[model samples]
Target: MPSEPAIASAPHLNIVPASVTPLPDAKPRRALKVCLLGYRSAPYGGGQGIYLKYLSKALVEAGHQVDVISGQPYPHLDPRVNLIKMPGMNLFETGLTSIRPHHLTSLTNIYEWMGKLTGAFSEPYCFGRRVLKYLKKHGRHYDIIHDNQCLSYGMLDIQKQGFPLVTTIHHPITSDLKIALSAAKSWTERLLIRRWHSFLIMQRKVARELHHVVTVSERSRMDIADAFDIQPAGISVVLNGIDTYEFRPLPNVIKNPNRVMAAVSSDQPLKGMRYLLEAVAAVVPKYPDLELLLVGTPKEDGESGKLIRELGLAKHIRAVSGISTEDLVRYYNEASVVVVPSIYEGFGLPAGEAMACGTALISTDGGALPEVVGDAAIQVPIRNSKAIAEVLETLLASPAWRDELAAAGRKRIEELFCWTRAAQQMTDYYWQVIQRENG
Candidate 1:
C-alpha cells in the first residue's frame, strides 16, 4: 500500500465567483426555502433516494426550510424536513409489464397506466404534474425547486412560471442505455432496451434548457454534456457526502478474515454484480473458506440470482437485504474488504461509505470511483472477473496491505467527503443560483 495522499478539493465551475466574494453587510438570514423533487425516494435502496434524504437533512440543519416532494417509496427524512407526498400509479410495484385496470381510477392514474403500457416511464412526468398541481392549489411556498433528476415537460412549466428550478442529473441515463444495448444478444432485446431508455430524450432536452443544473461528479458533468448536447460549463458539480459519524469504523465488531461485502442495488445492470459473482466463483476454489455478503437482495429470477446459482455460489453467498443502518455498519466493520464492481457510477456512494467505515476498498475505475477513491484504495478494470479475482486474491493474502489501505481510505473520507463540507458547498451553489436568477 502507498502513503496516503492529500485530499484535493473538487474543481468548481468558473461561472461562479470564488467563495471570498464580498456581500451585503447583513447577518446571514434563515436558510433558503428549498423544495427538492424526486420521482421515487427509497432511502435504503437507490442513490436518488439517499441523496434526497441526506441533502434535505443537511439543508435543514443549516436552518433552511426544506420540503421533499416525492412519489412512491417516500424517503426517510429527518423529522424537521417537511415531506409532501406525491402519489403515482407505481405500476412496476409487482413487476408486471402493463398497468392493469386496477391502476386507473383517477385521471393521473390513467395517464400513468397508459404511459407505462406504451413503454414510457411516466413517474417523472406525472410527479411533476402533481407537484405543479399541489403548488397551484395549496400555494407556492418554496423559494426554489430543486429536482433530483426528474427532468420532465412539467418542469419547464414550473421554470416558465419563474420558479428558480435547478435539476440534478446524477449522470447521463444514456450510459445505462448504451451498456444495456451493447450487452443485448438480439435486435429485439436491443429495441426493448432502447424503448426503456426513451425517457432520456426528454431528460436531455430538459437538462440542456434548465438554467441551473447540478450533478455529483465532473465525470457526470462531462458525460451529461455529451449525452444531452449541453456545454460542460452549463452544469455545476456538487459532490455528494458521507455521514462519517454514522459510518465510522467499529473496532469492537468482529472482523471475518474470509468475508467480503458489497453494497448493490439489484435492478441496474451497470452495478456489475454478475461479474463480481463470476470473480467470486473464480477465487472460491483457491480459498474454500471465502464467502460473499451482499447488503441488498438479489433480484428474483434476475441475471444476478441466476448467475450466482449458475456459478454454484449459493452455499458461500449471503445477501442481507432491508437491514438497519446500524446493522449495515456492523457488516462493513466485519468485512475484510468492500468491493464496488460497478460498470458505471455517477458517484459511487457505497465506495465512499465503505471508506468512511475504515474498510479497504476494491473499486473498479468506473465513472467516478477513481475520483472518489483517489489512491487510497486498489483499482481494477470494470467487467473483468479475472482482474477482480486477482486483486481479491492479493488482498486476501496480504493483511498488512489491507490495514494500510483501510487507514488511508478512512483518512481520505474524513478530510474531504464529510456531509458537513458537502452541505456548505451546496449551500453556496444554491445561493449563487438564486442570486443569479433574482438578479
Candidate 2:
C-alpha cells in the first residue's frame, strides 16, 4: 500500500465577508429531495445526533424537502422535515428482556441482541442492513441519500445499486478505540473496549469502498484517510455549524463570576473529564466558592464520579442532562468561562456553542479545536490539568479579559459558523454528487 498523505495545516478562517456571493455557478439553485440517515440521533446521544438535528432543520429552511430516516431515540427536527422511524430492539434502552418470540426470527434482530449481550456495538451495522432494505423498495423517492457516518457493508451495497450516496464521517472511531484502550485498567478491560469498537472493522472497509465521503473537519479528513487507508484526496471537508440564534448570548442573564462550565456527554477517556476534574480540584483550595457546572450527567460508578468524590468536588460539581437549548444558553451566559478539555474532537461543537453564547472560552488544542476557536479563545495542550487550572484562575480573576474574550468569541461564531451557510455549502456538494452520478 502507498504511504498516507501529510495532514494539511488548518486554514485561517478568521471571518467570512458578509458580501461574498454563493458558489460560482451559472444555473440557479434547485430545491432537492434529501434523505439523511442516522443509526441513532437523539440530540443527547452524541454529536452525530446533533449533526442530524441541525442539518435537517437547516436544509428545510434552505427550501429543500428533507426526510430523516433514523433509529431509536430519534432526532428533534423542524416540522418541515419528515422523520421516518426505523425501529430495532434499541437494546440499550429497551434491554435484553424486551425481546419477543418473533424478534428471534429476523437475522438482524438476532445479531443486534447477541452483539449487545456480548460487549459489541452493532447499531450502525444493523441500521445499515435495515436502510438498504428500505431504500431497495423506496429508494427512488429521494434525489440523494446522505448517511451520517453509518459506514457499514450495506452502504457499499447501496452504492453498488446505483444510488447517489454520500457519507459524512464526523471523525474516525479509531481514535476513540485507541483512547479507550490506553485508559483501560486491565487486559480484560482492554479486550472489552476493543470488542465494543469491533464495528470499526466494518467502518474501515465500508469507508474505503464508498464513492463520495465527507468529514466535519480538515483534521478529521486527514485522520479518516489515514485510519481507513483511503486517499486523502478522496475525502471532502465541511466544518460543522453552530445554531447561533439558539446558542446566542442573553444579555439580561446575570453572570456568575466563579462558575466554570463544560459539556461532557459521557465519562469517556477521550472527553478528558478526569483532567477537568483535577483542574477544578486544584483551583478550589485557593477559590473555595468556585463552582464546576457539567452540562451532562456522569455514571455514578464511572471514572468521573469516582474522581469527583476523590477530589472532594461533590459539592462544587453540578451536573445536568437532557437540557433544552434555552437552558444550555442560560448556563453558558452564567459561566465566567467554558472549558472543553477533550483529548480530541472532530469539530468541537461545545467550544463553538459556548463561543456563540458569548461566554469566555478556554479549549484544549485537540483535533480541529484550534480550527474552530482560532484566536477568539485561549487554547491549551490536551490533557493538561495545570494549564487548564492556570487559565481558569486568570480568567476568573480578570472580568475585563473575560468580557473581551466573550465579545471576540461570539463575533467569531457569528461571522464564521452558521447553519445556513453550512446548508448552502452542503447543498452544493449534494448537487455535485448527483451530477457526477448522472454522467
Candidate 1, residues 399-434: lDDT per residue as tens digits?
998899999999988876777767776777777767
Task: Give the per-residue lDDT digits (tens) of candidate 2, residues 348-430.
Answer: 99999999999999999999888888878999999899999999988889999999999988887776678887887788778
Best-fitting candidate, scored by lDDT: 2
Give the poorly placed runs of model 2, Cα more than 4 Å off. Answer: 1-28
TM for candidate 2 is 0.95
The residue pairs in collision within model 1 are none
Question: Local error of candidate 1 at 361, Å?
Answer: 0.4
Estimate the Cα RMSD of every predicted model relative to the unseen true structure: 2.7, 4.4
lDDT agreement with native, every candidate: 0.82, 0.87
* lDDT for residue 310 in candidate 2, whole number 0-100: 90
